[model samples]
Target: MKPRLHSQLDVNGEAFAANREQLLAQLATVEAVGRHQQTSAETKREKYAQRGMLLPRERLSLLLDPGSPFVEIGALAGYKMYDDKDGSGAGGGCIAGIGFIEGVACMVRVDNYAIKGGTISPAGMEKALRLQTIALENKLPFVTLAQSGGANLLYANEIFAPGGRGFANQARMSAAGIPQITVVHGSATAGGAYQPALSDYVVLIKNQATMYLAGPPLLKAATGEIATDEALGGSDIHASAGTGDYVADDDAQGIAMARAIVSSLNWSSLLADIKQDIPAPSYSPEELVGVIPANTKTPFDAREVIARLVDKSEFLEFKAGFDNQTLCGHGQLYGEPVGIITNNGPITAQGANKAAQFIQLCEQSGTPLLFLHNTTGFMVGTHAEQSGIIKHGAKMIQAVANATVPKISIVMGGSYGAGNYAMCGRGFDPRFIFAWPNSRTAVMGGAQAGKVLRIVTEAKMGAASDAAMLEKLESDTAAFVDDASTALACTARLWDDGIIDPRHTRDLLGLLFHLCKHADKVTTRTNQFGVARL
Candidate 1:
C-alpha cells in the first residue's frame, strides 16, 4: 500500500475557510443545546446539597477512573418532546456513556435525579435500550448509578410494555457473564425497584437510598397497612434482608464501594495489551471540518476523508476502476485492519455490484467494515433502471445485513432513501452508528419530496389545479422536511447513537475498534438462567 497524496483539499483556500465557518456554527448550536440541558440539571444542585447528596454528574465523575475519557451517548435525546416545552429536557433525564472504571471499560448509566426526579420518558427508554444493546454487543460490564422516581406517569402508557425489556436485558447480561452493578442513591419505587433487585451486585446508601415495590403512601392506600419508608425497604433493612450487597453512609462512599467492586472483578486482566507507537494520520484531523462542503449538493472525493482517517494516510484501494462512485478499500486505524465503504455520489448499478463483492471479500477475510454515508440514493433514471439497479441494490443490502463482522457507520452528509439501508443506517443495527453535525437522513431530499408531492397532487386535480396553491404546498413541504431531517432532530428521536464532531471521528473509530476486538478475543460463561438473589 502506498501513501495517498493530499492535494485535493486546499486548506488555505477561501472555500475551505467558508466551509469551516459554517460547520463550526452548526457545531456551536449543538453544543449550546447540550449546555442548556446541563444547566437545567444543575439548577437543583443547592437542593441536593442541602439533603447531603452529590449531584448526578458529580457521582459519575467520582465513579469513573481519574483522567479517563467518557464517550457520551444520546446527549440530546427527547429535545422539546413531551413536557419539555423548552429544549432543556434533552438527554432523556439521564447521563450515559462508556468509560473506564478501575481501569476496566464499562457502560455507565446515571439517572439525572435533579431533573424531574430522573423520570424516564419514552425517548429515555429508547436510549436505555440502545445503550444496553451496545453493552451486550461490546461485552462490557454494566454500571448504573440508580436514583429515580420511576416512569413519568405522563407517558406511562407508551413506556409500560417495552419497559420490561430493560429488566430482561439485565437478566440476559448477567446470565451471559457480563457483570451488572448498581448503586442506589435515592428513591427506586414501583418499576424502578426491579433495576437494583435484578443487578448482580447492589450498593445502597444508608439513609438516602430507598428501593421498594410500594412506597409508604402506596402501601397504605393499597392494603390499609401503614408502614414507614425505612421499615418497608430502606438501605439498612435491605442490607439485613440480603437484598443489598453493600451499604454505604453517603453518595461518595457508595461510589467508592462500587469502584472497589469493579476492581475486585479483575476485568482488565482479560484484555489484550494495548498496542504502542501507532502512526498518526499525515493530515490534520482539523481539516475534516473543511473537507465537507458548505453546500450540500457539492461533490467531493470520499478518498479525501479516507486520507485523513487511515494511519499515515495509507490505503489499499480495491477495484479502483470498477465503480468510482462507491469506494472500497483496506486501511489501518490504530493498527487494526479495517475495510471501508464510502459513497462519493449516488449508488449506480455498477457501484452496488462493486460494493456487494467488496463486502463478501471482507467477510471472507474476517475484517471489520466501516461505512461513511453520503449518498443521495441509488441512481434513478431510465438508464439506471435498464441497468438492473433494483436487482443489484438488493444484493448490496443483503451483503450488508448478513456480514458477521463489526459494522460501524458515520453519516457524514446526505443519507437519503434506500441509500441509508445499503450504507448500514440505524435500522440494520450497526455495532455503533454516529452522525456529523451537518449530516441529514431522510427518505429523500426536501426539494425532491416537495416536487414529488406537487406532481401527484396536480395529476389528481387535473385542470382544476390552482397554480398559487400548488406552489405554496411545494414550498411548505420542502421547509418541513428539511427542518425535520436535521442532525439535531434525528438525534432527538434516537436516530443515530449520537451526533459527533467531525474532528473526533478518527479517535472515536479507534476506540470502537479496540472494544470490538477485545469482545471477540474474550470468552464469557453462559448459563440457562441469570443470577438471582436467594
Candidate 2:
C-alpha cells in the first residue's frame, strides 16, 4: 500500500480566499435561477390552485416516499430560453430526478403545468430524452406526473423529429421489462398522447386528465365531428374503454394509485443490498469552493478535487510517473471501487496514451469510471503534432467510447476543444454528467477564438487591416464567445445534466455511483415486444 497523498494547500491564503469569493458569486447566480424556476408568481399560484390541480412539485412530493432525497436533474434547463424573459421557466417545463416511491427508487418526471402549460421546448425535449436514457440504462422504474400541453409550437420543427425517439425509448424500455407508470394529471394531446399510451401502467385523473390524438377543435376541422373532451378522450373513457389501467377521482388519488402500483411491483427486491456503512472522505468538501482558480486561465491541480471526493482522501495513482497531465488512478468512492481520470493540464501524447491504457484496465476489472474535466485541451503545437498527440488523443477517445463501465463526468473548469470530448462532455454519452457553476466549456478560450478570427480576417483581406475596426471585431467576438462558454449557457443547451454547488460534488457522485453499481448488478426479465394497447 502507498502512503496517502498529503495536501500542501494553504486554505487561508489570499489565493484561496479570492477563489472562494469568485465561486460564491457564480453559485449565487445558479441559486437565483433555480429559485425563480421553483417559485411562481402569486397570481399564477392562485390561478393554478383554482384549477383543482396540485402543482407539479406537490404531486412529486406526495408520490415520493417520506424523507427520501430527490436528485433533481437539469432544474434550470431552459434558463432564459425562447420567450422565457423572466428566467422563471428554468426547468424547461419539467422536473425530473431519481426519487423513492413506496421505497422503490424510480425515475420521476413531472410536467410543470404552472409554466406555459408545460410546453416542451427544445431543451425540455432534450431533458426528457436524457431522463428516459437514464432510466433505461439504470433499469429503474419510470414514473411521470404528466400534465403537458404538448410541444411548444414555435419550436415544433426541432422537437418533432427527436421527440419521436422519446416514444421509441419508452416502448423499448417496456420490452426490456422496465415498468413505466404515467399519471396523467392534465392534457396529453397531439403527439403527447403516446407518453401514457406507451407506459406499462397508466393512471388517469378523472375530469382533469385527457389524452387524445387531436382535441375537439382539430377533430371538428379534420372530420366535421363535434365532440366534448370527455367523449373523445377522458379518464372515464380510458378506464372504461381499457386505454387506462387505473382511474382516480383527483390529483392526490392519482398519485396514490401510482405509489401503490410501484409498491406492488416488488421493484426494490431486485437490487442487491448496498453497503451503507461507508466511511466519509477525510477532507472537507467545503474546500472545493476554493480549489479552482479564480481566473479561468489560471491552472490548479485536479488532485485537490480527488483528495476531497474519494474515501479517506486515498487514491492509488496509476502510471504515476508516466504522464503528469492526464491523471488516472483507482480509488474508492463511498466504499465502492472506481477508476478516476482527471486533468492536471492539457493532455499531451503521453497523457492521452496513459488515459487510454487506464480506461482499458478499469473496463477489464468492471470498475466504474469518473472523469473530472479541468483542461485547456489536448496540447497543440509543432512539437505536440510531431509527438502524435492527435492519434494518442483519438485512442483515449475510442477507449472512453467503448468502455463498458459506467462513465460519469464533472466539468470543474475549462473544458475546451477536444478536451471536452476526451472528458466525456455530452457526446460521449456518460451515464451522467454535471458541471460546476464556474465551469466553462467551448471549443477554445474566448481570447484565443477572437485572436484566431482576427488573424484569419486580416489574412483574407490582405492589406485591409483597419486597426480600429479590427479591434472592435476582436472584442465583440470575444464577448460573444465568453458569454456562450458560461456554465449557464451550456446547461441551458443541455451540454451537461445540470450545475451543482461545488461542495455537493462528493455526495452527488456517491449517490450516482450507487445507482450505477445497482444497475450493473440487477437483471430484468425481457420479452420479444413491448406491452401494447391491443
Q: Give one clash count per candidate, in the order shown.
A: 0, 0
TM-score against truth, every candidate: 0.98, 0.97
Off by over 4 Å in 1: 269-272
Question: 1-534, model 2: which lDDT tens digit per residue?
Answer: 434666767899999999999999999999988777767733367777887888888888899888877888888888888868899888888989999887777999999988888998988988999999999998899999999888999999889998899999998999998999999999999888889999999999989988899999999999999999988998888898788998898999999999999998867642245567777667788999999989877888888898889888888999889989899998888878999999999999999999999999999999999999999999999999999999999999999999989999999999999998998889999999999999999999889989999999888887878888788889999999999999999999899989999899988888888898888667788887888888
- Candidate 2 lDDT (Cα, 0 to 1): 0.89
Query: 455, model 1: CA deviation in Å?
Result: 0.9
Taking all chains together, the TM-score of candidate 1 against the true structure is 0.98
Q: Model 2 reaches what TM-score against the true structure?
A: 0.97
Tens-place lDDT per residue, model 1, 1-534, is 664746488999999999899999999999999888789878889988999999999999999989877889998889888887788878887999999998888999999988888898999999999999998998888999999988889999999999999999999999998889999999999889999998999999999899899999999999999998888889988999899999999999999999999998767532244567889888988799999899999988888889889889888888889988999999999999999999999999999999999999999999999999999999999999999999999999999999999999999999999999999999999999999999999999899889999999999999999999999999999999999999999999998989899999999999888888888876878786788899
Q: What RMSD does model 2 have?
A: 1.5
Candidate lDDT scores, in order, read 0.91, 0.89
User: In candidate 1, which residue pairs get closer than 3 Å at backbone N, Cα or C atoms, i.e. clash?
Assistant: none
